[model samples]
Target: ADMPGISKDRLNVKVEGDTLTIEGDAEIPMPEGMEPLYADVRATHYQRSFTLSSEMDTEKVEASLKHGVLTLHIPKREEHKPRKIEVQVD
Candidate 1:
């Protein structure tokens, strides 16, 4: 079952050694009520975070949120970037 509220592609991750940091937020409307409920909606802010992989590159990470959707683009370092190496023998 998929409960759709907000979705993030990468969530903007940065890996520093063994520490990974993720920062983002979501904007949800308060319940429809004329009067104050149990609690005010002012404190209904949204935020989320996560710990990333140790191999992630922190310097090339990017994140953005628009229209309630979040996008994260994490680019690894050249050394960490995935590629095939060819060897030549003469």
Candidate 2:
């Protein structure tokens, strides 16, 4: 399903260890000629949680949003990522 009203920019996310938290607000527009309907459709705050894999490095996690588009870049830990090492033997 496509959530046209809900885009990436309208949200904020934070990740910790194997868990990720998503928080954001959504705006709802009122229809025309709906004066009789008494309702409060303001942007409501929301939160969600998710479990991540062990390969993720919570310390290097980064996120940014522009023009209603959100982007998150999670870099791996130095020790966990591939690196060249020298072999020392006696």
lDDT of each: 0.53, 0.67
Runs of candidate 1 exceeding 4 Å displacement: 1-33, 36-43, 87-90
Q: Please give the lDDT score at residue 37 for candidate 2.
A: 55
73: Cα error in model 2, Å: 0.6
lDDT by residue (1-90, candidate 2, tens digit) is 112245566676877669988777766665786653554444466667778778788877787666545567878777778988899999
With a 3 Å backbone cut-off (N, CA, C), the pairs that clash in candidate 2 are: none
Per-residue lDDT of model 1, residues 1-90, tens digit only:
111244464234455565655543333545677645464334333444466665666677776656555567766567766798899999
Residue 71, model 2: Cα distance from true site in angstroms: 0.7
